[model samples]
Target chain A: MTHASLALESALRQVAAEIDAQFDRLLDVPDDPRADLYRAMRHAAIGGGKRLRPLLVFATAQLFAVDKSCAARVATALECIHVYSLIHDDLPAMDDDDLRRGKPTVHKAFDEATAILAGDCLHDLAFELLAHEATHADPFVRVELISELARSSGPAGMAGGQMMDLEAEKASFDLATVTRLQALKTGALISCAVECGAILGRVPHEGRTGLRGYARDIGLAFQIVDDILDAEGDEALVGKKLGKDGAAGKETFLSLLGIDRAREQARMLVDQAIAHLHAFGPEADLLRDVARFTLERDR
Target chain B: MTHASLALESALRQVAAEIDAQFDRLLDVPDDPRADLYRAMRHAAIGGGKRLRPLLVFATAQLFAVDKSCAARVATALECIHVYSLIHDDLPAMDDDDLRRGKPTVHKAFDEATAILAGDCLHDLAFELLAHEATHADPFVRVELISELARSSGPAGMAGGQMMDLEAEKASFDLATVTRLQALKTGALISCAVECGAILGRVPHEGRTGLRGYARDIGLAFQIVDDILDAEGDEALVGKKLGKDGAAGKETFLSLLGIDRAREQARMLVDQAIAHLHAFGPEADLLRDVARFTLERDR
Candidate 1:
């Protein structure tokens, strides 16, 4: 592997460890009936996924030399939202997936009620962590973080995107429609992760255009690659049910453009994402690598 | 009715109208797949219920002569959290209720996935509303409101209480256990509404003890009255199916204390709740009436 890719990989692991440790300390299990709820949250949140959102937070925060501990808390907050969405998404009323990270889904591991409450709790935890004075010395920064996360994940963003995805099963969606759906669903939070670090660094909103552009491009590429993997990747590697979109007759990039063109589209997005970071020096090499890693990841 | 009770009645309508108006404007539907999601949210959020939380907020905010618009926004934010919990709690995986507030539940009105997304979105919207600058001039006040709502609604508060309530179906709960369950479940958010008004008024932590006590007593009394209504209130008047607690074999204030004692306990708590506001003179008349109205409410 190239040195840049290796650095990205190491950072991924490090962020995952940081997030896991934070969640461990944050979600200390009390001896009560809520213990099961906490356990279910830990089951879904503690040690899974690519930790891509947290990685983005750390990478962008690093660009501004924001304090590591502060960034860590913010990163963890983003992951909590990401993980909470996954738990709710995997509910029986939604995806009905039994396996996530090769382990039983929260509802399957615990009960459906516990799964629901765990998701709700994690969502609340995300805001709580962001609003905490410890997340930033300035309350304005903290409120901004909370608002950004709220906007990105609420009805107009991630959850809205999921709503569109569910609707896609019944209606044919053109590429524009699909793009809008993807942007709201996965793209919004992914972009917010990058913006949060800049916010923590006290970067003004106007200064964040390039970073926002970079985040949007890579978000699309990452999602396109996700579709590609779902269509062709190994189940053992993916760690969850795959090819369900095709089976459910959902409209996705892969279905619209086919494998070859979808892969090509992802490649172009990665390049465009990197180009958006042209103003930065070697300090941005990790971000450039992250865009590349988006299309290259197997899971 | 007495003058105080008449004043309480007028404020309830005003708060409900204000809350409904805010939700109506906030959830303006766009023409897309998410239109259904937004519609579901509107159906659940824009109307119905007693608007108890919002009333609590406005009443308490009135104590410090807080700006009405600011109090309205905070009250709306609290209602968003309250409504989101109701949406999730009514889902098939949870209470599985078909009706809420005399109408079909969100899951019944829309698809299950849409209902889930609506609930998730509403939860996100709560923090979004709180973090907005219009909620408070001071960012510190905004962050405090966010954190407070997050804590009360999260696992250790309402959701945590929900988990315990779910567990109660399998295990017999004693009086103390039932009290704890009610405190966390129904009590936390109710208390939060009162505290939020204090927070908005910038009431310091130490000065909030009496308000906190008032909120807690009323929260308990509110739950007892809920249990009482569920046992004997008319279905048409109550607006939802009643007596599910008995069918579910859930241990409640009624089950542990029985009807006569439960009634007596609720009366005592209402008296105590008013006593918590003893230092406040005539300005606290509405609050005292609200405490009295808790046990007197038939729905």
Candidate 2:
């Protein structure tokens, strides 16, 4: 790897480590008799992979030279939301996957009831962390962050997309329907990460739109690549049972457009996403690397 | 019904109708694209319960002679939380019940993924309603309401209680364990309702504590009576399949202490719950009636 690549990788490695450590501290099982609840929540949340969401926060904040500590709490909060969604998605009623990240799914490692409540707890913890006065953003900004994240994850966004995907399963969906679903289910949080990064960086208004567009384009590209990988990727590398989406009759980009077409679309989107970073000058090279990394990363 | 009973029933019925209508008005179903999500969310939320939470809010506000509009939005918000919890609890991975209030559960009526997303969306709508400064209480009060409800429902509260209860199954829980579990799972929301009522009513701190105590005791009694009824009541009257708790090795007061002793304990709790209402003098008569209703209601 080149120096910048190593710098980006090293930065991401540090992000993963810091997020894991902070999460561990934040979610330590209390000695209360009801500590099982805490433990289940902790188990569901801690020791995740690349910490992609927090990395986005850090990288976005770095573009404007914002202090890392200033972004830490919200970074943790973003992970909380992501983790909660994963737990819920793995429940027996949903994907019913017994494994996640090559480990037992929360419901499998714990019990279904505990997994359900743990997910529920994590959802609230995200908002609770945001609600804290100590987070110290302007009140309106806090409200905006809370509201935006809530909308992105709630029915109109991620949840809604999941519902649409479930409803459209195995039925020949058009490219538009597939793209719309992917945008909501996968892209919403990714876009939120970039938007939040911009928020933390206090990016000027015109620059803010550019950053958001960059995030959106890359986020959608990321999902398209994910769909491509699901069709062709190795199980050991992805750390998940491959092609389960196909087996489940789920709707995905590759399922709708084929691998070649999906790859083409991803390339196009990456180009557009990178274009948005041009106004940032050299300071956004890391972001440009991230856009490329999003499409190129194997796992 | 006697005159007082008739009056209370009619008033509560109106409160329920008004709350539903108000919620219906607040919901905006976007055209075509996202309309299905809005529709599913409305379907899940609009058709449930006697609106006891909202009734409590309205009644408690009445106790302070607060204007009806002052607490109306909160009344709706509380019901939103209650509805969301029920939707989630009835999911196939959770209680897996087919029936609730004499009709199919959301998961049974809809698909599992839709049910899950519907619950999640409902949760967001609840907070969104609270965040709307135009709708109800002041910002500070609204923030407090949001914080309290979030805390009550998350870990260390309702969800925690559910986790403990899940574990309590297959084990012989003592009275203390049973009580603690109920307090968190069932009692927290009930207590929050009464406390919220008082808060919206602008009741003094002492009154808030007194109402909270009343709610807690009555809530516990409500669970005890539910246990006793489940042991002896007809499934037709209960409006759902019954006896699964025993089959699942779930712990309940009647299961632990026998029906007769459980009934005795419930009556004692009702008395204590009523005693706490004395702090509000004659204005709290409705709360006392509700306490008695907890132990005496046929359903």
Candidate 3:
């Protein structure tokens, strides 16, 4: 591996460890009936997945020299949202997946009711973290962070995208429709992670243009890569069921563009994503690596 | 009816109209697949229920002369959390109720996926509303409101209570366990509505003691009344299934304390709730009425 890959890998490892520790300290099991809910939450959120969202927040926050503790808190909040989405998505009513992160899903391990409550609890915890003063000394900054996270994750953003994706199995979506769906489902939160970092750094709205562009491009590339993986990647490496879209006869980037063309599209988008970072110096080296990593990641 | 009951009735009518108008404006159906999600949210949230949570906020905020529009937004946010909880609680994996507020539940009106997404989106919108400057001019006030709402609505509060309530179906709970469960589930948000009003009014910690006490008493009274209604209320009057707790063999206040005793307990609690308003003058008249309404409400 190149030095850049090594740097990204090390950062990923560090973030996963930090996030696990934070969740551990935050979600202690009480000697009450709610213990099962906490356990389900810990099961789903504590030790799992790529931790890509948190890594994006940290990488972007590093560019502005934001405090590590503040960045860590923000990262944890992002992870909370991401993990909660995963828990809800894995429910029997939704995707009906029995496994997540190579383990039994929350609904399968615990009952479906506990899983739903656990997901709902984690959802609230994300906003709670962002709204607190510990995330930022300036209440103005904290409020903005909360507002941005709320917008990206709400009906018009991430949830809207999920709604559209659920519709995709029924409706035949063209490239433009697929692009819009991917933008809402996966791109919104990915872009918000970078936007939140800018908010934490007190980057003015005008100052975020480049970062926003980078996030958007990489967000699309990330989805294209996801479609490719879902079509062709190994389930063991992916840590869940694969080719689900194909099995469901769903339209995906792979189905529309074919594997070779989808790969090319993702590559081009990643290159454009890196180009959006022209103004940043070596301080943004990690973000540049993230864009490339989006294309190169196997799962 | 007495003059005081007339006053409370007028206020309830006004607040219900205001809440419906506010929800109508906030949840417009977008011209996309997510339209179903927004429609489901509207079905669950608007044109239904007693709107008691918003009344609590308005009543409490009125005491300190907070801005009406500001109070209105906070009330809506609280309602969003309440409605979201109802949507999730009514899911097939949870209570599995088909009817709510005399209408089909979201999952029944739409599909389960849309219902889940609607609930999640509404959850996000609550924080989004609180975090926005339109809710309050003071960032300090806004952040505090968000934190409090997050705390009351999340795992350690409403959701945690819900988990315990689910457990109640399997395990035999005593009076204390039932009280704790009810406090977490129903009382937390009701209490939060009052507390949020205090926060919005910038009432100091020392000044809010009476209000907190009033809220706590009324919250429990509200649940005791619910237990009473569940055991004996008419299906048309209650607007949903009756005797669910007894049918499920779930332990409740009515199960522990007999009907005469439960009604007596609720009446005592209502009187206690009214006494907490001794520090305020006639401006607190509505709060006193709400406490009385708590015991009298059959639904």
Per DockQ, the best of the predicted structures is 1
TM-score of chain A of each: 0.98, 0.94, 0.98
Docking class of 1: high
The per-residue C-alpha lDDT of model 2 at residue A299 equals 77
Query: Per-residue alpha-carbon lDDT of model 3 for A1-299, expressed as tens digits?
Result: 22348889999899999999989998999999889999999999888888888999999999889999999999899888888898999887889998888999999999999989999999999989988889999999999999999999988788899999999899999999899999999999999999999998999999999999999999999999888888888788888998799998889999999999999999999999999999999999999989998988876
The TM-scores, one per candidate, come to 0.98, 0.90, 0.99
Give candidate 2 misplaced runs (Cα > 4 Å): A1-4, A30-36, A62-70, A199-207, A248-251, A279-283, B1-4, B26-40, B63-70, B135-138, B199-207, B258-261, B281-283
DockQ, computed on Cα atoms, for candidate 1: 0.94
The B-chain TM-score of model 1 reads 0.98
lDDT of 3 at A254: 92
For model 1, how does the per-residue alpha-carbon lDDT over A154-174 read when each residue is reduced to its tens digit?
988999999998999899999
Docking class of 3: high
Of candidates 3 and 2, the better by TM-score: 3
In candidate 2 chain A, where is summed lDDT lowest over 10 consecutive residues? A134-143
DockQ of each: 0.94, 0.49, 0.93
Give the fraction of true interface contacts kept by model 2: 0.48
Task: Provide i-RMS per model in Å.
Answer: 0.6, 2.1, 0.6
Candidate RMSDs in order = 1.4, 3.1, 1.3
Summarize candidate 2's per-residue lDDT along A32-121 as a digit string, tens digits.
556776887777677756577788877887887776765777788888888888888887777778877777888888787777778888
